[model samples]
Target: MPDLPPIVDLRQSPTALRVQRGVMRFLRAAHGFSCFAEVSLANGRRADVLGIGPKGEIWIVEIKSSLTDYQVDRKWPEYKEFCDRFFFAKPPELDPDIFPPEEGLMVGDGHDAAILRMAPDGPLPPARRRAMLLKLARLGADRVHTLMDPGEPL
Candidate 1:
């Protein structure tokens, strides 16, 4: 397979961007999951990283670059509706104890990450799952389309 092109995400902070990259890398390499970043959800909230496993299990990872970001953002709970599992990924130096125990946790650098605390399974409703599957498919297709033909509007 050809190597993926480097795409810069202007919306993320340096620390947040690193956390997002490492989380995406870990999901793909360790769990055979296809991941996308800055995903728009049904609830009007954007997800930091959204992934679908080989078995079609959906996961949403919320990245926290600093303690302030985590504390200021109370919308993470809303993300649970769109995924089978949810996680908070951050730099290894950050204290994991600040995160809620019910959700998953990950710690690493920009290179790679590990799922230090596994999240509980919260299966989505059948209708919602079907909708999200469609959303993911369309998002993936749009990305490919844009990557292949930059002049075309997605």
Candidate 2:
């Protein structure tokens, strides 16, 4: 048998992981979006949850595990430049009103989430949308290829 390279182990805080799961469940089960976690936007900021809908609309969700988490993350606003809609997903215990009124709200547990309000659409420019969709396709293909061939070079 040939020797194989070690697999990378991505770690996340338990709280963050739970929130991610909840956000993903909500995006998939409720919104019919295909989601990817920890996706890097062209601006170099990472989105906690990036969802692509059937009609090519892009949504970015910033997950806040605690009050402090929400307070300290100032870069979430920049995510709007890259996506059509933006939202904040947090534990059900947090008050949805605490977030910005113009943005969307989602309350989630470890398994699911409920949308308290709908996000307003801010459609992306055609060029940016095309670029983003290409990036997403490449990322998806890379992930699938890696799973199929563990030693494949990215």
What is the C-alpha local distance difference test score of each model?
0.87, 0.81
Which ranges in model 2 have alpha carbons more than 4 Å from their true place? 1-11
Clashes within 3 Å, all models in order: 0, 0
In candidate 1, what are the lDDT values of residues 1-154, reduced to their tens digit? 4333223447788888888888888899999999998889889998889999998899999999888988999888999999999999989888998999878999868899999899999998889989998998988887777678766542
50, model 1: CA deviation in Å?
0.6
User: What is the alpha-carbon lDDT of model 1 when measured against the actual structure?
Assistant: 0.87
lDDT of each residue in 18-98, candidate 2, tens digit only: 778888887898879998888878898888889999899999988887788788878888899889999888887766767
TM-score of 1: 0.91
- Stretch of 10 with least lDDT, candidate 2: 1-10
In terms of TM-score, which candidate is strongest?
Answer: 1
Distance from true location, Cα of 131 in model 1, Å: 0.6
TM-score of each: 0.91, 0.87
